[model samples]
Target: MFYDVFVFLVIILTLLILSGLVSASEVSLFSLPSETLERFSKSKIRTHKLIAKILEHPQRLLITILISNNFINVGIALLSTLSALRLSYAININPEYAVSISIIVVTVLVLLF
Candidate 1:
């Protein structure tokens, strides 16, 4: 039981980090200057070409990021809820109250970092 909870917490943390990275990447991509994008488009590097392709349709990229970020956030919320449930069970606390507390704490943590 302890090990399961530990693993779940680790997964939740990993999801949070991935969510942050995706959010940051979206901002970084949108903030790139047109000149930089043009230069990247002309480059022979495979990664540069991929980035250029993604940037060609900024709206599509934005939509994709938003969708992915939503999924990640949901995953984080679900995992945290489960963690709270497990903790509350172990401590003989009410699961209903734990749910609200978990969501608030997770939201604050995500926003803080």
Candidate 2:
């Protein structure tokens, strides 16, 4: 039981770090600081419009990144839960019960946040 809990913690922490890195990379790619822009870079404002134009398709970029990140996070959660159950020999436990409980806890915590 203790070992399973430990493994779950390790996995969760690893996934969180990975997710944070991905988010940071996305933010860096999309972020534009006005102070850092060149004096002659058209319009003089460091707006995302320039980035959007460069991307060729802005909406698709947002959707694809959002969907891909969500899929990865969900996959990580499921894998962590399954790893816990397997470690504890709790194979008979319902996956829905475990996942729903996790989702409920996360939703409540997010609301608090």
Candidate 3:
């Protein structure tokens, strides 16, 4: 009942955070100039070196990011719909209004994140 809705909300929030991080990483990774990438390549840090190596093929990186974001977005939509349905059933309200509320809340969360 209420517990299921709460679980959905929690999952939705987590996905929103993940979506934001994925979006940020895409921007940050692509915005790096060649010089910075070169520096990273030469750095002693393994993580930096790996980043430089991965950035060599921009197409693959971009595709992976887009795919992940798309999946997260889909998950968010599915969960939102489920939670909205549960909420409507629990409160005995019109499903349309519950759906509208879910849409608004999801939009705001996406924008904020």
Candidate 4:
């Protein structure tokens, strides 16, 4: 019973840490300026053109970033669920249920969005 409690605590802690990282990244991404985004948007084009593109469609750029971030978050959640299954035995009760519900929600989100 003690070991199970420990595992549950570990799983909850892991989820919290992951959530913090995701939220931080989302906030940082939203905070980035058009010029800063342009630098990375080019991918391979000239910096000047990238800046121009970003300036022209800032909202589109932000939307794209949001979409990408959502996809990444879904991927991370799914991977975490797999990790939980591998690390903990029979992850289908209590804390494991939390992970299961989260996985299902993420899956639904990925499919719906």
**Can you give the TM-score per candidate against the true fold?**
0.92, 0.47, 0.93, 0.44
**Native-referenced Cα lDDT, model 4:** 0.59
Candidate with better TM-score, 1 vs 2 = 1
Clashes of 3: 0
In the predicted model 2, the residue pairs found to clash are: none
Q: What are the Cα lDDT values of the candidates? A: 0.90, 0.59, 0.92, 0.59
Ranking by TM-score: 3, 1, 2, 4
Model 2, span 1-113: residue lDDT tens: 66666777677667666666667656775564644333224454556446535445646766776776676577566766666455445656666676666666544532332
Q: Estimate, for each residue in 15-90, the C-alpha lDDT of model 1 and write its tens digit.
A: 9899889989988999999998999999999998899999999999999999998898898898899889998898
Between prediction 1 and prediction 3, the one with superior lDDT is 3
C-alpha displacement of 73 in model 2, angstroms? 0.5
Candidate 1 regions off by >4 Å?
none
RMSD for each model, in Å, please? 1.2, 6.1, 1.1, 8.4
Runs in model 4 deviating more than 4 A are: 1-45, 90-113
Task: Kindly list the per-residue Cα lDDT of model 3 for residues 1-113, writing each as its tens digit.
Answer: 99999999899889999999999999999999989999999999999999999999999999999999989988998999999999899999999999998889887877776
